[model samples]
Target: MSKTILITGVGKRVGFYLAQHLSKSGYQVIGTYRTPRPELQQLEALEVQLLQCDFYDIQQTEQLIAKIKANNSSLRGIIHNASDWLPDSDSACSISTIEKMIRIHASTPYALNLALAPLLQNNPLQFSDIIHITDYVVDKGSKKHAAYAASKAALQNLTLSFAAKYAPKIKVNSIAPAMLMFNPDDDDNYKTKALNKALIKQEGGEAEALRAVNYLLDSGYTTGQTLKIDGGRHLV
Candidate 1:
């Protein structure tokens, strides 16, 4: 039987692509999305089990954990890819903004890992994974997205802690990427400026992220480390 993997925030973007790729790669994918989108129908056709979850609500998160535990006796991996981009400059409640960011990016992953570690332990291959999808802003603080950056930083820090706690049982790691792809609505000036920040000078694409994820899953000795796929943005 193909091992099962759970991925959060698969409504679109990298998370969506990961779910699709991993499904085709022979893993049983169980994905979560906060909001319904047409793409989810495609995933369902591919045998990807979809769940609706809102990480901000603790009850909803708990219910998701319960559902996973009830359905699967074992899991091979989990990818925390669900995220929200909220600039502090936005006219929202300041405390709410920070809290929401932490809740989705940090709090949700923390809860899921603790609750799902047992399922991960039952992997037939004896190697399980928890991969956090972090952001490049984690290294360089963002003035406009301070809360978002800090939350991702916290998620990265969890990689170290969970790696130690799980030890020989499960491996915990992170992937930090910058501008994997641009939204269709982004203008030319915005794209040019964004591309200029990366040494690679292009959208890194979902393939880059897939490569990083595959490396971590296939490795025997990699844990507690982050694969930086930022196109060398830190060098700029």
Candidate 2:
């Protein structure tokens, strides 16, 4: 029987590519998106199920897990790719904005994992996995983007906590990626500068992200570890 995987915020970019690639790899994919996007119709046409659930809403998060559980289907894995990148101006860096960032990036995943722990434990499959997509900036710490970095740092800690608690049954890992698929229309100079910072001196793409996921899934002995797909960005 084919395994089922749920990918949150899979309407575009890395999340979308993950859903598409995993589906092609023979896993049944259920993708969640906040707003309906026409591009996702292609995934639906390919028989990938699409569900609308806003991670920002706690009640909706619970309902989404409940609906999946009611189907009597066991989830093979979950990829938390949902994230918000709201830029904060000098005046707008208030408590509310920080709270929102924490709620969306850190709290939501933590809550969802707690709520779904029983379902994960009940899976008949002996091996299961969870991949949390985090940003490379968490370690470097962006000067202007403090909230985003702080939230992701908290998330990184949460990933460690979950992995330690869940143990040998459920493997939890994280992928920290840098400069993957920026706006196509942007000039090459910016891209070059970004690439130069990496040890590989080349910008990464969707394939690197997929590789991290595949590694985590295949490496049964690995947990509580983060695979950085940043082309050595942290080296500089």
Models 1 onward score TM values of 0.98, 0.94
**Alpha carbon deviation, residue 222, candidate 2 (Å):** 0.2
Best TM-score goes to which candidate? 1
Q: Encode model 2's per-residue lDDT on 1-236: one tens digit a residue.
A: 22888888989988899999999999889899999988898888768889899877788988887887776456788898998886666675577677778887888888878866766777678878888899998888887778888998898888899999998788898898898777778788887887788788765888889988999988869999888888777668
In candidate 1, position 157 carries an lDDT of 99
Q: Which stretches of candidate 2 lie over 4 Å from their true place?
A: none
What are the per-residue Cα lDDT tens digits for candidate 1 across 118-174?
999988886999999999989898999999999999999999999999989799999
Model 1 TM-score is 0.98
Model 2 lDDT at residue 10: 86
The per-prediction CA RMSD against the true structure, in angstroms, equals: 1.1, 1.6
Model 2's TM-score against the true structure:
0.94
